[model samples]
Target: AQSVAQPEDQVNVAEGNPLTVKCTYSVSGNPYLFWYVQYPNRGLQFLLKYITGDNLVKGSYGFEAEFNKSQTSFHLKKPSALVSDSALYFCAVRDNVGSARQLTFGSGTQLTVLP
Candidate 1:
């Protein structure tokens, strides 16, 4: 079975500073990793994905993540943080070998960007 681990329950960052939300995953076969963000009352929105590409993958809102194969980690990073970036972030993973497209999501990390 595959699973995602988000070590932090919340991440606090100052506006204009860099921000990161950690994520590590485990799976039996090759992993397809993804990141998503959720607003106060909105559904989870896809941020980016790592299907098969360069180690560094860029996504929406200036967010980017590095796919570390050895570490099995995909940590989201942003050069600068903004107040509007405060939201819940999730890391999801699924085994590419399986026919099922089910994704196992992390516990979710609430990012708080202070002005």
Candidate 2:
């Protein structure tokens, strides 16, 4: 079985400050990790992924994530946050050596960028 966890239910950051949304995962095999963001009344938008290669992956809206295999963690980061960045963030994982193609997602973390 594969699972993801976002320990923090809410993350508050002031505008123009750096922000982070933490995520950890457990899986049977090598994990394919992903990050997605959802705005109010909108579907989840793909943020970044960690499949292989570099430990750091960059994505849309000036976001990036670092994959630490030793720690089984993939934490999302942004150098500077915007009020518009406020959204529900999800961390997901898929087992690389499984028949299950579906991704198991975290409970979700609501990020609020205060102005």
Candidate 3:
């Protein structure tokens, strides 16, 4: 089984300040992690992924995530946040060796960047 957790239900940040959205996972064998963002009335947009190789993965809209094997975490980060960056963020995980082809997603974290 694969599961993901976004501990924070909501995250608030001031414009131009650094922002982070935390994610942690548990899975059998190796894990494939991903981040997605959803705006108002919009579908999920692919932000980034950690399939293999690098521990640090970069994604769209200046977002990046660090894959920490020891912590089983993939925390999303941005050096500076924008008001437009406010949206719902989701963390997902999939078992690399499993027949289950679906990715398990977290409940989602609402990010509000105040100007």
In the range 13-104, model 2's lDDT, one tens digit per residue, is 99999999999999999999999999999999999999999999999989999999999999999999999999999999999886889999
- State the lDDT of candidate 1 residue by residue for 1-115, as single tens digits: 8999999999999999999999999998999999999999999999999999798999999999999999999999999999999999999999987687999999999999999
Candidate 1 deviation (Cα RMSD): 0.7
RMSD of each: 0.7, 0.5, 0.6
Instruction: lDDT for model 1, please.
Output: 0.97
Q: Write model 3 residue lDDT over 1-115, tens digit each, in one string.
A: 7889999999999999999999999999899999999999999999999999989999999999999999999999999999999999999999987599999999999999999
Worst 10 residues of 1 by lDDT: 94-103
Candidate 2: pairs in clash: none
Stretches > 4 Å off in candidate 3: none
The Cα error of candidate 2 at residue 31, in Å, is 0.5
- If scored against the real structure, what TM-score would every candidate get? 0.98, 0.98, 0.98
Question: What is the Cα-based lDDT of residue 114 in candidate 1?
Answer: 100
Residue 107 shift from truth in candidate 2, angstroms: 0.4
- Residue 31, model 1: lDDT of 90
TM-score of 2: 0.98
